[model samples]
Target: MSRMSTPAESLTRPDGSPIRVLVVDDEQTLADLLASALRYEGWEVTTAGTGRAAVRLAQELTPDVIVLDIMLPDFDGMEVMHRIHGHQPNVPVLFLTAKDAVEDRVAGLTAGGDDYVTKPFSLEEVVARLRALLRRSGASAEKPANVLEVGDLRMDEDSHEVWRGEDEIHLTATEFELLRYLMRNPRRVLSKPQILDRVWNYDFGGQANIVELYISYLRRKIDKGREPMIHTMRGVGYVLKPAVAQ
Candidate 1:
């Protein structure tokens, strides 16, 4: 029987080291479930069921990212985040809460959280959100180089040049940034919200069509008369990879 693959299985840090993540939730079942899912991405995952434990693990492990629950048995996630923030101010934190109010989300962001996800959320959304945070935080240990290569796609981070195979492609600054993100996570499917957050640097609200427009521009430049690389997962989002063999 063939086994099913998960979204996390396709993700990797540019440096090739396992990305470390600390999961903090008062519910042990939820915490373990999240840790198991993240581990599928080849991440070093640690779980803590209380705020105190969360702070201790955050200090000890120095994880690249954290998924913290808002309600904890001892103290709230905000206090735990404050404590950990003092030690590793640069580390990214994603708040998971059962509360879905707009004010709650705002409060979490105001409290040093990098991202927020409400409860009863899809695990895929959490993973994608964490991946976006990791990228924004520069969790990779490798020094950035002028050039990035994913399959035949190449991007010069300094000169803002792009090439597919031997053909040079011209792109606007926005387009270049978008393509660079795609190249960074070659085979992994990235959601449009994630794209907007990383490439546009803010919430685009209902301007998701912007992503489609830029994707069309990219396809025209890079995929025309060539083995197409950019793919759409219908309702999900886009992915960049080598052309599938016919």
Candidate 2:
């Protein structure tokens, strides 16, 4: 099960730097999950577990956007936002509130928050919200090409078209997604579990064999009759790299 596809246009700062984000939440697990999701979008993410930490990190990072939880161990998120806004007045904030806490949601927005998400939100929702906030803040004005390339292989993410050297290769949706993941992290070995979570959106459980199946499928289409770009490491995992011409 593939995760939700990101926006077609990759967002970056005017100077082409990764978008900076600050995530503040007392729940360590939730904070880590949000940070992972944001980093997957190619943004820089910093996490803080308390209001004081949030304020301090905000000042240090001067982040482009913030995801703040309303309840914190130290002084509450409102106070943290106030202190951060004192120095970074123009930074956008997206608040996290409990699903039943309507008052907290209203207060957060009234207190200058730019957006809010209830608890138990999906990672995709948070990522989408943060992207919208970044766009609205005018912090990310550069839209990088929606293409991935390694050596002579090219993939148009928006068009979902693939090419190997001069030959256009047709791929199924799953094959395209698998190839996209490999192309995104060229030369980096990806374990079966990682591929399952990212591409299949599930735990390993007993499904490791599926990764091998897909790798074989991709190889026949992408590597057959050409210099091989996908390679397996015994007892490790798999990697995709540029083919070395003989």
Candidate 3:
């Protein structure tokens, strides 16, 4: 951690080191883009094009964060996530899936994916989410109280507001709660039941549709015309991930 960092960097190890990230995807171009974006953010970055290679690299050089794609040429991303977890359970995994299907999302969650993003994503959003994840993980990255910035998206927890650059984002009470939860945890998968418990009153007897409706509302407002951030996990729940690779 202290090896590849410096002072003045926002998120770094306690010794003032840059956060290191490993990106796993089959698409060389997409992985390169994400690696470049992360590196530009002052974090050390690496890439792996297959599950086996990803696992091997992670073992040899541990990274603070891992951006994993669900689909892979050798083993699937889910399996790769498992192997990584087997090696290091506490490490955070942010999934890069093609879609927000319930099955894929649940599988990733069950397999221990911390967070994820769908395809055709904005690099800015991906960067923001990664930074936020590092902050939440307390992985010697950033402080929790610090303002979280992902691309143009910014949220000041102390102020309880979100902004896309200079423009402010208007959110309903429920929307605010949902977004807050997602931001707080960053890349961790929050199941529907889990989200309900966290966001709404535990005793409140709301239908699942409430969760679905809120997700739709959030997507429409937060991700419309940009990239899908909040996503659905069929037969499971929802997650906030980065843009998925094609």
Clashes of 1: 0
Candidate 1 lDDT, 206-228, residue by residue in tens: 45766787788789998999888
lDDT of 2 by residue, 33-61 (tens): 88877887888999999998888898888
The candidate, 1 or 3, that scores higher on lDDT is 1
List ranges where model 3 is wrong by over 4 Å.
1-9, 144-246
Model 1 scores a TM of: 0.58
Query: Which residue runs of candidate 1 sit more than 4 Å off their true CA positions?
Result: 1-5, 8-15, 141-246
Top model by lDDT, which number?
2
> Which of the predicted structures, 1 or 3, would earn the higher TM-score when compared with the native?
1
Residue 234 in candidate 3, Cα distance off native in Å: 23
lDDT of every model, 2 decimals: 0.79, 0.79, 0.71
Clashing pairs in 1: none
- With candidate 3 superimposed using the best TM-score fit, by how many Å does residue 140's alpha carbon deviate from the native? 3.6
